[model samples]
Target: MARVSQEHLEARRRQIIQGAARCFSRDGFHGTSMQDIFRETGLSAGAVYRYFPGKEAIIAALANEVLTAVRGAFDDALAGPRPAWPDEIIAEALRRVDDVLLFPPALVIQVWSETFRDPRLAGILHGALIGMADAWAKVVASYQENGLMSADVPPAHVARVLLACAQGFLVQRALLGPLEVQVMSDGLRGLMSMGLRRPPEEEPGADAS
Candidate 1:
């Protein structure tokens, strides 16, 4: 038997994932068949199976990829150079949140809808989401340490609240018409301001006493 190189295996895996994304995004998970994956990838049935043991494996792989991408984006946006004013940083981060809401991995919604019916899958999805949220909370904590966050607010709690608002906006728009994206952006900004920006001291450059 010819030994398959690691690079070749990874490439094949990526091809399968891209094909799965296309099928899942268009026909949805339940609607898509293994045949759809084969057709989308232009690979033989045997080759598809060689890459992914089953359809469920493909779906799970896709979900992991999306979660990684989302987490990476959040990290980059949060760690960017601090803005001159605290509000500016909040605004940029809020905009990034809106961008995430606008276009997310199809697998995210797929796994979320199916999780409740399947306990094992629900556990997997929940773990992945909670890990991402925890990573995001750390970034929020940085601002708090720098005194950029408001004195009265809890950084971790605020991170959770902002993430929830972003997710809710996405859910609403998915069920409704092409509503304004800025609505989510503005709402996120308001939440950040309430919990992040410190109140100005009576005197400029003086710490709140």
Candidate 2:
């Protein structure tokens, strides 16, 4: 038997994961079964198991993919030669969220549902969020240096707040649909714009708004 190339193996795993994403998006985690995933992928049971031992492993793969993408967005937000504005950072992060939501917007709801029962998955999320928060802290510090954000709040605290908002936006956008996402996006922009407005003390000879 010819051993499979690593590229082929990874492609097969992604194919199964994409199909499983469709299933989980339609059915809640409890409602979804391995058989459903097998059917969704149109792959034999043995083929599916070759990539993922069980449904839990499949879900973990999806979650990790999401975490990696979100972390990459934060990295991009800070990689430019100049610091990005708050809206720029949020927009980039939201773009990553939108990319994952493509598989099915409802998929995140299913993932969140399973976290209540899955400690390992929950730990994965906790660690991902910590890493994400640490990256955001750099963005926050950049904003402070640019005088776009207040200096009183610690960068870590600001990162936590932005992360909470982003996570909340993900759930709410998934639940309420794109119209609400547009509204939430506008709201976030407005709030961030408020932060960028310089205080009179900081603005030299500025007229009161």
Candidate 3:
């Protein structure tokens, strides 16, 4: 009977997660096995099972971990000191979006592919998306009220559209030969600026239709 300190328990769990990440990144979720994780972590099967029920559980945990970090990063940007201008905030937002893409796209593809067949998994992914969108919508709505964003656009709809666009961009890149992510990201930043910025008033339409 060994009494493990809480710190040691957490360390062991983190070790398992690291091992799982390596295995999944190298071999993918379907290709990985419990024994592979055991070998990677140098942990007994029982010990690993004590922390996670199975492979699916491990994947779910990993997705949650990634999504939580992303949400936290966005919240931090929104809660930062007020920007001098709307473009500043929009630039920061685009930079954050690029940062989110730093993670391997395969991880997201794995989760979504599994979700179609697993109701529990689907629920987890759906809930995360909804929560993220809701939080973003609230922030966008606040900015709109402050005249930092377009008030005509519905916050929730804009949030959803942004997320959909980001996801689509990644998926397309994954399928289409690793398109230049940075260039695409910059273009999206420009698009955000163009849409959110109000044009300067013209003098008597300048005799143009």
Which candidate leads the pack in lDDT?
2
TM-score for each of the candidates: 0.67, 0.84, 0.75
How much is 27 displaced in model 2, in angstroms?
2.0
Off by over 4 Å in 2: 1-3, 180-185, 195-209
Clashes of 2: 0
RMSD to the native, candidate 2?
4.9
lDDT of 1 by residue, 70-127 (tens): 5666666666785223234334444554443223334456767877676766777788
How does model 3 fare in lDDT?
Answer: 0.71
Winner on lDDT (1 vs 3): 3
Worst 10 residues of 2 by lDDT: 176-185
Name the better of 2 and 3 by TM-score: 2
- Candidate 2 per-residue lDDT, tens place, 76-108, comes to 778888887655666667777677655766688
Query: Tens digit of lDDT per residue, candidate 3, span 120-155?
Result: 888888998898788768777778878877677789
Q: Is candidate 1 or candidate 3 better by TM-score?
A: 3
